[model samples]
Target: MVYDKVIEIIKEEFDVDEVNENTLLREDLGTDSIGLLELVMAIEEEFDIEIEDANLDDIKTVKDVVDSIEKIKG
Candidate 1:
């Protein structure tokens, strides 16, 4: 459930259509720092959870976001 919604959020935020678990946000989607911050904000609002600033550095792919959301929601 989280993965699907996350994919939607990412697609909307990045305006990309080909997003998957292994898709790299930076190398593949060309997501910059500001774009990442915006993505995180959207994810937080969608899930109603807080993602720490420190953890943002570890997010490299779509799966990472899904994992973070699952961990936070758990």
Candidate 2:
């Protein structure tokens, strides 16, 4: 599942012990612009997909990332 895969990637990338749907990409995980770029690249490589930059602007939480991935995959 993209959600599970995305969460695992996020946890490892952010060095977080745990995360949930409500976890904020910026406030909760402390993701900066550069970190966000790295994360997007990582997810793209892991899933063999492309996450457009415009779409990224709408991503705020863990669930948002998963949903975006699902949309790209679909």
Candidate 3:
């Protein structure tokens, strides 16, 4: 559920048609620093959860985002 929502958010935010768990936020998705920040904002809004600034550095892929959400929601 979270993964699906995250994928949807990524697609809408980055305007990309293809994405998966392994897709890198920067390389595979072409997300610049600003885009990444925007994506994080969108994710925070979508999931209604707060992601720490410190944890942002650890998020490099789709799965990482999903894991972050799950960990925070826990």
Give the top-scoring candidate (TM-score). Answer: 1
Candidate 1: tens digits of C-alpha lDDT, residues 8-32: 9999998889999999999999999
TM-score, each model? 0.98, 0.95, 0.96
Single out the weakest 10-residue window by summed lDDT for candidate 1.
10-19
Top candidate, metric lDDT: 1
Between prediction 2 and prediction 3, which has the larger TM-score? 3
Q: Which segments of model 1 are wrong by more than 4 Å?
A: none
Worst lDDT run of 10 residues, candidate 3, spans 28-37
* Candidate 3 clashing pairs, residues 3+ apart or interchain: none
Clashing residue pairs, backbone N/CA/C < 3 A, model 1: none
lDDT of 2 by residue, 1-74 (tens): 78888889998999998899889999999999889989999999999999999888898999998888888888
CA lDDT scores, all candidates in order:
0.96, 0.91, 0.93
Supply candidate 1's per-residue lDDT for 22. 100
Residue 48 shift from truth in candidate 1, angstroms: 0.1
Give the better candidate number (1 or 2) by TM-score.
1
